[model samples]
Target: MTLYGFRIPKFAALFFWIVVWEIVGQFELMLLFPPFTEVLAAMTDVVTTPSFVEAARITAYCYLVGLSLAVVAGIGLGLLMGLVPAADKLLNMWVNIFLSAPLSALVPVIMILFGMGEPTVIVTVFMFAVWIIALDTRAGVQHVSPSLKEMAFSFGASRVQRLKIVLLSALPEILAGIRLGVIRGVKGVVIGQLLVSIIGVGALFSLYSQNFLMGHFWALILILFAFALSLAELIGRLEQKVEYYAGARG
Candidate 1:
């Protein structure tokens, strides 16, 4: 970032906000926001607790399992839609609808079908993540050069070979979609847990909120934010690495 003709580090904005938060917290400007330092201190305590360890394990399990399912289903659906115009015509409208819908409202339906358990949370994450990934993948596959497919065909490449070529050609957009899906999946997991209110981090959030443990609450939030940002950054790096594929396609 630049300010007054001087370059500023990207984190400078974060630091400034942290300072503001601390000041407001110190002055008791908001009842919901406790001191930042207290929250940091509470973080260590929170992480060390056995309950937190168990909750973390459950949350991680649900997140990973759900996201894995999303990746597989989304990519497959995207490939199908991209390759088959009939599939695209049949499913594109619903995909777009779900992508734009307030997915939280659907969680109760998932809970009813899957039961009020980890399965529900997993499905929630999958639901939140899958559509965008499929859409992006479809876009990437559709944008693959016709000449590339023609060359593959002329070379006697099998159907699977052609599909592989399309996947590689669309790698950049696929990665981009996955990155976005990951972020949404995090939100899904959190929201799912919160709505469920009996499992994972959501349970802990309920515990903290009911008992007025704001410090611990905020600490957990910070942890979630950090995890989401870290994963996004990692995927973004991977996206950059494959950008040449997009250029090649172009």
Candidate 2:
């Protein structure tokens, strides 16, 4: 319905920032911060490079698979905890311990246990993400309206039917936890790559940094920032869409 109001502001902001960057480069503000043009050129060059493509593939692979596993496992564990009080109490302390502990610190142990490989990286991401999701899922299941379950049961719903009809009905809240887990998982997996990757973006970053290619270094970061932002927007929109459709049922 409205188009003219949006593009102008975004274009204006882009130009303003580009002008500021060029001016900062010209003045040599501090002995650091490469020219924006250099960074942009580096970004273009990176996209064309074979190594960059490989690194991108590896990173995306680890993040997507690990995050998926985390979400599925988290939902199952959360539902079990929600339905069983004794299981919840027993798992609570262990969950809290892992949730509070520094996943980054475990990198060394993981490397020792699994050696340097993709599995280790994915596991690191899983470690950083899964507990928070599981905890949130458990809370979501517990908070599901009891009346809904009663209504389902009154219809002679079998145990499986009750779960399918009433328990899994709180998908919105559960998915919220999953979204949070995925965001954290992706970041953790990338960071884990930095710690032990031999052929991912993290490795490329290390290579450029050591060679003093500050332009390329920042260029990689810009790529990652763009990727992260785009993925976040995509998932947020999907979640909203699902919530809207599910709300109609309610």
Candidate 3:
């Protein structure tokens, strides 16, 4: 970023917001918005607590499982849709609808079907993430060069071999979609756990918020935010690394 005549580091804006937050918090503009310093202090304490660790573990488990399912199912279904026009025509409308709809509205239905357990939370995350992945993957597959398919056929490639080649060719877009889907999955897991409210990070948030522990509440949020950002950053780097595949696709 740039000021009048100088450039600022990327994180400068974040620090600026932190300062503003501190000022508002110090002045007691809102009781819920505690000072950043207090939140940091609370974070230190929270990390050392056993309950926090357990909650974090549960959340992590749900996140990993949901993300894995989303990636596999999304890729498989997207490939099917892309390769088969009839399948695409039949499912495209539903995919678009789910992608644009307010998925949180389905939480109650999920709980009813899954009975408010870890399965429900995992399913919630899957619902939140799978559609975008499927869409992106399908688009990538559709865009694969016809010449490449013809070449594979001339070489007498099997169906699985053709798919392997296509997947490699479309890796860039696949990764891009997964990156976005991962971020959405984070939001999904949080929403699911919170809505279910029986155990995990959501329960901790409820306990802290209900007791007016603003610092702890904010600390927990910061932890989740940091974790999500870290995951996104890792995937982003992977995206950059595979960018060479873009040229190869041709």
Q: Which candidate is the best by lDDT?
A: 1
Q: Name the TM-score of candidate 2.
A: 0.84
lDDT of model 3, residue 192: 96
Query: Per-candidate TM vs. native?
Result: 0.98, 0.84, 0.97
Instruction: Estimate, for each residue in 1-250, the C-alpha lDDT of model 1 and write its tens digit.
Output: 7889999999898999999999999999898999899999999999999999999999999999999999999999999999999999999999999999999999888988999899999999999999999999999999999988999999999999988899999999999999999999999999999986479999999999999999999999999999998999999999998898886577
Q: Candidate 3, residues 132-236: lDDT per residue as tens digits?
A: 999999998988888888999999999999999899878888888899999999999999999875678999989999999999999999998898888889999
Candidate 3 local accuracy as lDDT? 0.91
- Best-to-worst order by TM-score is 1, 3, 2
Candidate achieving higher TM-score, 1 or 2: 1
Whose TM-score is greatest here? 1
- List per-prediction Cα lDDT, in the order shown: 0.95, 0.79, 0.91
Residue 183's lDDT in candidate 3: 91
Estimate the TM-score for candidate 1.
0.98
Q: What tens-digit string does per-residue lDDT give for candidate 2 at 1-250?
A: 2376754555577778878976786687843467888889889988899999999899999888788888878878888888899999999889889988878888888888878899888888888888888888788677777777788888888999877754456666676777678678867877789886565888998888898887788899888877876777776777776674244235
